[model samples]
Target: MTIEVRVPTLGESVTEATVATWFKKPGDTVAVDEMLCELETDKVTVEVPAPAAGTLSDIVAAEGETVGVDALLANIAEGEGAAPAPKAEAPKQEAPAASGGGAGKSIDVMVPTLGESVTEATVATWFKSVGDSVEQDEMLCELETDKVSVEVPAPAAGVLAEIVAAEGATVDASAKLAVITSGGAAPKAAPEANAQAADGKAYTATTPGKDVEDAPSAKKAMAEAGISRDQVTGTGRDGRVMKEDVAKAVSSASAAPKASAPAAAPRAPSPAEDAAREERVKMTRLRQTIARRLKDAQNTAAILTTYNEVDMTEVMALRNTYKDQFEKKHGVRMGFMSFFTKACCHALKEVPEVNAEIDGTDIVYKNFVHMGVAAGTPQGLVVPVIRDADQMSFAEIEKAIAEKGRRARDGKLSMAEMQGGTFTISNGGVYGSLMSSPILNPPQSGILGMHKIQDRPMVINGEIKIRPMMYLALSYDHRIVDGKGAVTFLVRVKEALEDPRRLLMDL
Candidate 1:
């Protein structure tokens, strides 16, 4: 029997991917759950796994060819190895002779279904140990997908018999994780729900004194948060703390204090070890897409940037004065972006070409503003759109932009939130950028870059005065928008921002 291997669902907004590399070829014996090939999408790389322990019979999708989600990638001949192992290991029926129990059974703890398009997860943490007793529905381990962290619960009240999947190992949905032996006594079962380890608090399957390994992303997060591994509640396989886990620990006051981590003793380097080392890693789907899109924009568009400076004195004073009442009335903090977004809306209306796209010999103009706000994340930069920005009030705009930014950092924003924006606003001010020429997000003809606000001496009515000023760069496609229109559009935004009454009175 030949079982067809199909592409699993890609994450939100990603419908298809290119076959980057094939790990196995036809006639090659592959174990059940072994990766057969890699599918590179716009957001992330997905490994296509073998459906059964068998010889690869045929390749349906060749490397570099695009294939949609659920499309056939290859075929595997079943029973090529000892009757293929089940997607999940079944519990042993026979009881061990030493353990006096009726029909000793062991149930497999398999990876649970996460959500749509999520096929596999990396083991982040394991709460229970081999020979440890666990209660049903209790969190046994945590699984980290590309987007979120999920805790795996115990399926049965029994002793953890064996761990099939270790921390940092990635497994498919419904794949075997560990074995739980029913009616078996734990060597030293804890009396309470949250009991500490007797030998040591470190929850791992490794030998004593061995340094615990963390996934690279998780390590970076932990380091940035100034947290040691033991201080975090791990959700990765084998009780390994993931990046999100550290983030949560940093946020919560109740999180554990720093614990001494096992150190790897330093050794004198050999001649080979002293040489410069290099490593190569495949670009993630998100990074790859970003590169492609930026290059495409540069190649296709007649890009030109127009610059101007804005005095933020009045806007800052307005915010400082009404921020308290604004937050109370709207349930969201007043921000500079909302003002800019509203100002841009009015400007885009005056210069419609900035909000237009080229559609193969025709120019398509949008009446309403769909604003894309660029936010940086650990994975990469993402721009989630605020639909119909022109129709929204200051409070509404602030709320929408804030929510998108929060979700972007947490990796919770959906693909729909990322698609279809008429104009983009990228604020380099938050990162202390003095000036930058922001790139245009294609299809959209324009992008507005906001720079850091600095106190500078400026001439006012022939007298020098200190004022808060910001440099703004408007990058637009010259193919659709003329230099005059672009400059006028930027000036309108500057006028609206400089004088707050213009935004309130629709000036």
Candidate 2:
């Protein structure tokens, strides 16, 4: 019997994905849950797993192809005839069924509805060569779309037999990618979720090796994969392959059956070797959106920034004294951000114009403060809101800030977490910046930029004293917030920070 395996729907509205890479080939036996391939969207990456235990019969797709959520990826023969055909079709629901000897079967790599608006993706890459052995749940290829990257994995275990698509080709979300056949005599399929590789293991733990020489190559495979090296079953000695083994893996990647090294692709130029050429990747959806929003704020608002300086001695002392106690009691850190955030809240309350939003022809002012804090991530910048700043205590504010910060780093924050903020606070000092003219978040009238605290001598009561001081900046929508409002807003923040109790007192 030839069984068809398909890609599953990634999420609601997400229609397609891009092929990332394949982890297995034909002729290899795959246990259940063994990773087969990786898929990518512009937003995130997903792992594809094998659905059965069978010989990998054919490869219907090549690397760098796009496929849909429910498209046929491969076929698995019940016994030794597992050809492990490669799937090349991008996801399309109209795909007809292909059967084996007695009858051709339909292999379905499902069309992925990644988001409400996303209907299709471009196929990215395929991992296996025809005749190579494939294991269940081993990655086969990758797919790409507007949101993130996606991987296609082996559907079963078997030897590879076909190549479906050429590399760098595009396919629909429901298109086929690859196929696998029963492993050995066809062991009962294991649960997919429970078939994950060992934690932090050098290679695929489910297929651990007893030999020792292949150890170095296994480690190398893990590193080049960069994303899910854990998903690959190591063929190295003791299942350990170091970085040095990458050349060997690449050389043998395209050959199967009686394997032989294929000609290597042209190598990428190193910075030291190629001084003139600079390669840049395309901008991500989030980054493009961020650029548009920031430029919109600049063009739409009459913005201006004012600067001020404050001594940091008192604030430093307070943080040093209460940091441990506050953390112990509230389960949150005692950081300078809370102080600055509180200060901004107090200041915004005093200068209402700074907290107002420009809604078309009207100046809509907010009574409650929803402060937006800027957090940096590999994707770009995201500002998450600390809702109802007036109502939360210092510890609560710190806790909220930290939680949102973590979420931003993990790319787990949602759209709702980013909306409805009336003002923004950005701290460049965390990266060793002394001062910066902060930009404003759109609609809101003001933003505050915090600078590094440094020791400098200054005259106080007719005597020079060394003290830690910081510079603050307030960027405001000058159309609503005049010079007075800007200066007042910054002072309020400075005062609140200097007198830590003022934020507590609501004064």
| Backbone clash tally (model 2) | 173
**Highest TM-score: which candidate?**
1
- Kindly list the per-residue Cα lDDT of model 1 for residues 270-299, writing each as its tens digit: 877644232233344456667888999999
Single out the weakest 10-residue window by summed lDDT for candidate 2. Answer: 189-198
- Candidate 2 displacement at residue 382 in angstroms: 1.3
- Once fitted onto the true fold, the runs of candidate 1 whose alpha carbons sit more than 4 angstroms away are 1-296, 299-302
Name the lDDT value of residue 13 in candidate 2: 63
Error of 2 at 101 (Å): 11
**Residue 72 error for model 2, in Å?**
31
Angstrom error at residue 192, model 1: 23
The alpha-carbon deviation from the true structure for residue 20 of candidate 1, after best TM-score superposition, in angstroms, is 25
Per-candidate Cα lDDT values, in order, are 0.78, 0.65
Clashes of each: 13, 173
